[model samples]
Target chain A: MECLEVYAWLQAYLDSGVTAEQERAVEAHIRACPYCRRKLVAMARVVNALERTSDISPRADFTRRLYEALEEEAGHPLAPRPREPRR
Target chain B: MDLRLLERCRQGHLEAFGDLVSRYQSRIHTLAYRMLHSREEAEDVTQETFLNVYRALGTFQGERFSPWIYKIASNLCLDFLRRRRHSTVSLNAPIGPEGDIPREIADETQLPEDVALAGALGLDVQRAIDALPPKYRTVIVLRHIEDLTYEEIAEIMVLPLGTVKTRLFRAREILRVSLARSD
Candidate 1:
């Protein structure tokens, strides 16, 4: 396979979702090709970084806050009244 | 505790709605954070998502809650991204507290100091991800981080399978190039 096609297969191959036959072809190409291997490694690094990003847990009071917002919105008058025609 | 609570929520029980909020708030907030890369926005989006979900709960038919909740969060995230784009804002640019910075390639099991050093790189990588356009970023996060199948992502994104695959590939390429530039 050409370089672009192999690169296209790189993500699925890493994901281990490609068909076995196609997987063998990708594995063979990457094993023989240094360039494709490097591209795969770079992609893998990005995936690694994504996995390790900050946790960013929600606030402890989030439930309270959500209810408060819900209450506020619920309390609001729905449907604006029609204004009288201006002279 | 029971699906009956969800039914009550659908019927407009305030307490039931509160229960739903308590149950799903974390997951909603996390999805928002991952999507928007902004804590405040995530919080706001999560609240909005629950409120919207509550209003629309009667229409939800599936026994499983995951897809329904995710569908709401993803739609809000997509709309937010679109509006931000129209306004020409860079959502990936850093904002708010820097305390929860990510750890880089360094061993996660390392000493606190080493972990701190790695965090800077980790934060940079996340920012790079945040910088991605919504289409690509959504695919990357769903497929890799969220561990959702491409078929599921395609269903959620309402795109063809081939289109999803193309977006994911190009997203990875963009992230790779961004990392190389940083180094």
Candidate 2:
């Protein structure tokens, strides 16, 4: 397959959405081509940057504020639903 | 099976709601912040999302709750971005040949608090995400930052599955070129 075809498949390839035949072709093409490899790496870096930040926190009083808002919206307290213990 | 909290939430249980909030507040807030690029708006969206979730609990009959909640959050984010859009030529105009260029009204004001809360991204990478058009940025943020599948993204965005794939492909290439140029 041409580099352009591989370009079209790169995202799906990373997603593991491509067929085995298409995957092999992409692998073979990347093994032989530096430019496509660089493109793949660039996309990988961008994805990695996004994935690296998984520990984002909201404000300390976020739950308090939400509960307050819910109460205010309901104009009264709603009972807490009983939770089942995890097995 | 995974929607146990949602089942409790359906009964108007405040504690169940609190537990639910604890479960998804960070994720919902992160998604909003990534989409809106503003700490203030992210907080507002997070607050509003749960409220809507409470009010609309009857509508959620799905087996899994994440996609449903994420759909609510993503919709709220889109509405905010739409309202904030102004009539300015965007800063990140196309560098490649024309055709699939994403045109967005620029909202370039990232406050100190915004940067303070931004998780692991350096300024340049953040700017690259900021520079993308809203549609592409939404796809990138949903797929990459939210770690959502293409099907879930399609649902959140209310788009066809094929459209989601097309957008993801285009968004990745655009980011690749933009990040490389920034380097």
Cα lDDT computed for each candidate against the true fold: 0.69, 0.77
List the pairs of residues colliding in candidate 2.
A80-B14, A80-B15, A81-B13
Off by over 4 Å in 1: A53-55, A74-87, B1-5, B11-23, B62-64, B88-121
| Best by the TM-score measure | 2
Q: Write the per-residue lDDT of candidate 2 for residues B1-183, one digit (tens) a residue.
A: 337767776665557666787778888888888877777898999999989998887788777788888989988997886676544434554333542453343445667775777686766666667666677878988898888899989887889999999888888887778667767
lDDT of 1 by residue, B46-134 (tens): 87887887677778776756666777788899898778866874424323363122223232233443243232336556566766767
Candidate 1 docking quality: incorrect, acceptable, medium or high:
incorrect
Q: What is the lDDT of candidate 1?
A: 0.69
Q: What DockQ, between 0 and 1, does each candidate earn?
A: 0.21, 0.47
Off by over 4 Å in 2: A78-87, B86-111
Highest-DockQ candidate? 2
